[model samples]
Target: MSAAIPPADESLYAPLQAAAWRLGHLGQSLDGFIGTAGGRADAINGPENLDHLHRLRALADAVVVGAGTVVADDPRLTVRRVAGDNPVRVVVDPRGALLPDHRVFQDGAAPTLQASLEPGPAPGRAERLVVARRDGALALDDLFAQLAARGLRRIFVEGGGQTVSRCLAAGLLDRLQLCLAPLLLGGGRRGLAVPEAASMAEALRAPCRTYAMGADVLFDFDLSV
Candidate 1:
């Protein structure tokens, strides 16, 4: 069944309207694992939560993911489960290891942008965006600036753990939506890896709200505020 996200206050998204707003989304188990040790994420989220992801993709100007996620999931990254147009797909692949056969490159449902550290030709219908490196890694700030130059303002960072962690660490994430399933994966990849705080006061806190997407619980945090 399909589910609707609770209506957000207009002010909450006002900052996004002016420029590129990056939002991160993750679906994890009760124990806070996005994938199993074997790197499988097919059954992490239920139908409703899956629908919610599609809704997010539909709403955003671009859907971004890491190269590892594409290699692991081979997702189409389209708005197939929801009612809306597909957003552009942005892949952060510093090594240029992603193959042209990946579904996102072949589907052609949306424009694909590939960010690589070295200058090279992108396969399939994807456009190669050469990003500057800071200490031998793609500079996240430059990547966002390039996307903004293309007029892709609202971006959805849906990814593997490492990519999400990078965004959170860099303070590039303006909003976060974590949907928790009722299952527990004892050991696996974490959803987000922010720095640990010494005390509760030092912990990262943001204005948060919750909603029910069928059996799953969605926690919405407004980091932009």
Candidate 2:
């Protein structure tokens, strides 16, 4: 049976219209795991959450994901479930591990950009975007600047945990949307892996609002404040 589609909440996504906005999203189980230890996460979220992700992609000027996500999910990163144009697809592959066969590289459904640490020919129809590395990680500032240079100011970081964690830790994301499913996985990949804080005072406490997406609950955090 097809899952119920939730109604769109305009107020929930009003912050995305801000100038130079950046939003990150992740859907995980109630127990705080995005996938199983063996890398199985085909159905972590319901159809309503998937529709929400497609809506974000449709609104974004560019949708970004880490190489790990592409390798695991092989997502096309297009706005198929909603009525909007597709955004530019970006993949962060600092190590240049992805091949030419990945769907995002060859789909040709939307313009694709491969952000890497070294300059090289892009695979398939994608373009190469050489980025700098800071502390052995892709420099988020440089990536954002490069994207902005191409008029991609409204960014969406749709991820596999590590990439979203990096943006959150760097304070680059203006907002974050975390959807929690009702299922519980005892042990698996974490949804968010930000750096550990030594004390409760060091923890991040942003103002947030919650919405019901069918059986899943979405927590929309306003981080720009």
Candidate 3:
């Protein structure tokens, strides 16, 4: 995903909406978060992030989530406001629980590709890819290589926490974007993973960048190059 910097990096212009999305999500919310405590909208789902996220949809080659994410979020995964073409949609539905009846499979824009370990093809027009794996999840290396072959640069790995944390723990993440909302969930759920690590440095280390958007702060993780 490396490239020469465009002159408009510091500001967003009308034509470069997609570019803006990629740069903006450089440090986005942790997992999924949105809105403030006192707001009418409440939940882990943050509607505030949607505007810029549209830009990200245009820039990414694919928007990926684990099946758990798809079932929980059921995101349309489209670029509603951005200028560029929509990215491909991918779901790591290892066991194929994300049925065709889901709205996601119904979207025809970029098309939804399910990367699973299931034996047969999924019904309907939804594409099925059998990824090699021991457990239900696809092998990370195989998944990325296939994506690369399809020219899916700057793939966005959205998540259900476990998948995102897996990418982090295996050092497969190129960048990490986290959004911090002002209010605390306290007992609901954490935004990132707390996998057992050998050391504190290992736990916290990544290439770093930061920025602000509305009431949220974003963190860009730079994994070792």
Candidate 4:
């Protein structure tokens, strides 16, 4: 494990600080206003986030994302974070809708594990986790328990908005680190889109510290459960 995040408890059965759930907005303002690229507006959190994720990835055994994110971004979930062992890329596809050739499972970046409702006789040339679910939502609690048992105890829940919201509302997240971009969408997709925050202030809960990334203010919410 990386010597970065310390354990929050002793037993470590409950979940140690070794794991972190990174929830950030992929916005222009948030990027330009806070996290900058080479002293300029960082339209995204830039390498700062990549670096943070890297630290988390080094300690974590698996990195996860919702299928929507895969379809939308088609990200190649690899650990360019600072180099250690390459973490396993896990995708959540309840109905196996990731479209066989999205490039997320190609190129041999790392082993891509697909957890779906059906086995389908193939793990898409990667790894397969034929999990059962009721409403297509993978039994989150059970999945996490199994992941922990599989040595993926320190897990990172990287995501799409809905996925992040669901995981947090379920109280399954241990910590949430968000890098707030400066630009305001006013109406674009929100970086953090979940249930209605009781109020704006309540929504952007206090005790939440803010840091200046580049042009955006990094709002890190410590959702340590």
TM-score of each: 0.90, 0.94, 0.77, 0.74
TM-score order, best first, reads 2, 1, 3, 4
Worst 10 residues of 4 by lDDT: 32-41
Most lDDT-accurate candidate: 2
Indicate the worst ten consecutive residues by lDDT in candidate 3.
19-28
RMSD of each: 3.2, 3.5, 5.6, 6.1
lDDT of 3 by residue, 15-111 (tens): 2334212222322234443222232222442454545566556667788777766666567777765466777888888777677876668867667
Clash pairs of candidate 3?
27-218, 28-178, 28-179, 29-178, 29-179, 30-179, 34-46, 207-222
Candidate 3 stretches with Cα past 4 Å from truth are: 1-48, 197-201
Candidate 4 regions with alpha-carbon error over 4 angstroms = 1-43, 197-207
Which of candidates 2 and 4 reaches a greater TM-score? 2
Give the lDDT ranking, best first: 2, 1, 3, 4
In the range 183-209, model 2's lDDT, one tens digit per residue, is 999988888987778999998789999
Per-residue error (Å), model 4, residue 10: 20
* lDDT, candidates in the order shown: 0.83, 0.88, 0.60, 0.59
Please give the range of 10 consecutive residues that has the lowest summed lDDT in model 2: 1-10
Best by TM-score: 2
lDDT of 3: 0.60
